[model samples]
Target: MSLAQPLAELLEAADRPLEDARAMPPGVYTNPEFLSHEIETIFSKEWICVGRSSRLAKTGDYLTYDLAGQPVVVLRGKDGQLRAFSNVCLHRMSTLVEGCGNKRVLVCPYHAWTYDLDGRLRGAPFMTQTTGFCKENYALPPIRCEEWLGWIYITLDKDRPGVAAALGPLEKLIAPYEMENYVECFRETHVWDTNWKVLAENFMESYHLPVCHAATVGGHSRLEEMECPPGLEAFNYHWITKEASLPMGNAHPDNRRLEGRWRKTTALITLYPSHLITLTPGYFWYLSLHPKGTGQVSIVFGGGLSPEFMADPRAEEYVATLKGLLDEVNAEDRGCTEKVFRGLSADAARAGHLSYLERPIHDFMRYIAERTGGYRRAFAVAAE
Candidate 1:
């Protein structure tokens, strides 16, 4: 099928320089056909982040997620290794697991077909009498899984590059924060009424923080103090320096890794398709998004404190404070992004010139365009 007109136009806009860029067109968010295209091209091939490795701290701990149309389960096995397997029963094709939990063995609820933690078929009831039924032939298929800087990522495309190699430079850029050492205090999932891209763009820019987040982090954000630099091949980033609205937003008194300005600065990073991270000196949080059709998004929202804060005497209080503040901030973001989606569906919705603060969104649009087969036409705008 040919590319849709609205999405084609959006790709053209995405190629422009920061001074001339515009908001993406509305149809890209509202079109079911376009979402399907994205699922096939981007979600299926990219290294999609499931969550932080800290959540699965023990053997047999597992979490389930649906990528595109495939059911997936990421689990820690008896050998202290993490693995991803298809969460489908080989017998009747029923889903093996639903959510996150500890499972000694994967037991299919449909007919009690059991599988070992390593994806081997351990048992299958009532199949002995059947002719030509060999348990040895069955096993949960393994998916491509890897750990990069404490975060777990999985990909359906076996040939895709490993996360560590793809994000090597990112590790060096964030080395001082020691991201892997941050202890995850909480992880929650929510379904919101907005296109996934809308939510992603909201997190990519702090332009709306002073207004949309007025009741929370608004007062602490200074537009002029924000910095937007050119993005790299794998990711985009921006920096915001200010007196943190929450104490945990700054470095702990015990922190020795960061000095002077680094203590008060926050890095807002977007890792290709949809991993958004806000890393501060004392804490870090992230949102991993998946589309739930044209009008909704599935979000894996999680965060926690740095090693210094985790080792502090008031760690419990700090965790409570950080969780409470993040909850409020998420509520504000949901409200703003949902409103943008609603407006996009209106007849009068038209693309508008972008602010310098929204440079990352422009970069994100270009990434999507490239993945969805619009790259040839999209990059032409850049050359012009």
Candidate 2:
């Protein structure tokens, strides 16, 4: 792929030494042209997380969302399998479903073309006039889908690796948390008036927590306790090993079995393109970011409790408190990221020096550069 001059330069800057590396250039965040390139190369190819298996626990339960520019539907079939398909009908290409709910079949509102929950065509009205057409030959095209640790992910690019293959050893690192059994207790979707990278990078590091989130979660943040070990082949993560400060004190009696730092700290991870998960001993939360365009992002912001947390007698009451704190934390994040988006496009705005704590952002930039075909250089001697 031929690189744009500005994008090429941004990649070059990203490839520099960590101490000298600045935040990515302003154009990387706000340029519509670059965003288009990302949509085609990165969004279209990555196995993006949409939601969790808990979202569709019963047969016929389904959900629909747009990825890149394509509408996708993932549903639980009658056979107890989860599948993904192009949500457009085979007839005139109208959307097959909207929002999310359990149903017997996916019926196209345009002309009554109906499909089974697994995306098999079940009904098509009066189409015998066409030559050599068979109902079996025209099922909705399957979109690549896979579930990893209870999360459902889909990719538009058939050639890309499945989520498990892409994530590789990171799964073992998180295995101690038993994240697969966790529940999707709550979720809120909204459009943030900021670039997807803005929210993703913001969520990746704690550098701004002391300042932007001071009134919220930042009060407990101790920069000295943080660690950003080198990233992996598929992702980057940092340890926010501060003492737990939740009403439940972040430590669960049942979770005491966990060894060392993990028993008391949170693992904040950015799984490539965009799957952000914050894993604490008691709970886990995620930000599934989908870019609406260069200037906007659609976020599925939500969290869940570990089995340990759910087993507590005060579980019900603590849920409400947890949700409220998350809500406030989300607001603080919104304020900071939106303002940063506005700053990125300013004439005087320039990339600034990065703290050692912002190592994940540096890793994230290398991901952007590689995925967008901006550069072929390696990121830190390759993770393996």
Strongest candidate by lDDT:
1
**Local distance difference test values of all predictions, in order:** 0.89, 0.84
Query: Which digits, one per residue and each the tens of the lDDT, describe model 1 over residues 10-110?
Result: 66776787789888888888888889999999999999999989899899999998998899999999999999999999999999998899999999999
Worst 10 residues of 2 by lDDT: 375-384
- As for candidate 1, its clashing pairs are none
lDDT of 2 by residue, 89-177 (tens): 98889998888889899899999988887677887888788777677877889998899998899999888877888776788777777
The RMSD (Cα, Å) of candidate 1 is 2.7
RMSD of 2: 2.2
Off by over 4 Å in 2: 1-3, 126-133, 377-384
TM-score of 2: 0.94
What lDDT is obtained when candidate 1 is compared to the true structure?
A: 0.89
